[model samples]
Target: MREIDTTRVLCSLAELEVTGGRGFAVGEGDWPLRGFVVKTASGVAAYVNLCPHAGHPLNFRPHRFLTSDGNLILCHSHGALFARDSGLCIAGPCAGQSLTAVAIEVVAGYVLLGADVDVERLANDPL
Candidate 1:
């Protein structure tokens, strides 16, 4: 994955969940990172949090993206389910369509995306 400067600060590793419940910020997006996951061994994975099925956020609530079994990402809009590892819609109307992935990396104990960036401008914007 290329770098995405707008996707910054994926949260402290200490505050992240094991099954990967986390949120971050995208300087260019309407909202900061709302629905995201952090797999301990796979770095960080992010999405627009919008379900492809009905154009709604996948999480039941902000920062809450998970299934009862914690194996899939559930779309609160229609009970659609997506495989967390691939973000592929496995059931429901969104099946086949997937969440858009945001690029990210860790540096100096911080997570940062390194694409579609205007670093100087983003630094000047409010959080």
Candidate 2:
């Protein structure tokens, strides 16, 4: 088996305010894995930007994945509400579905992609 390096720094933990979020991309060229990171009470969580309902990016505005109160993740396309910690759609067209999680880790105050992620594959495929 061959191992592809998908590890990349998404951002510094300090960049995300508590309950706030930020979008990021891995790889380059036409297809890069698009994702976002949210700072939670326990830690940071990351997920693919694609929304399951319409298969569209969750937020039209950069780093605006959270609701006004920052309690849940919001998909602007259809008003899908998701649990920020679990990415589970609590309501909307895609209810019961989830935003694909992008494994991540906090290292030295920077958010880094986990070793298991396949950038090329994830970039080309939507779940």
Off by over 4 Å in 2: 1-7
| lDDT (Cα, tens digit) per residue for candidate 1, span 26-48 | 54555444446545335556555
TM-score of decoy 2: 0.90
Candidate 1 residue 124 Cα shift, in angstroms, is 20
Q: Each model's TM-score?
A: 0.69, 0.90
Residue pairs in collision within model 2 = none
Per-residue lDDT tens digits for candidate 2, residues 54-123, read: 8899998888999999989999999999998899999999999999989998777888899788888888
* Alpha carbon lDDT of each predicted model: 0.61, 0.88
The numbered model that scores best in TM-score is 2
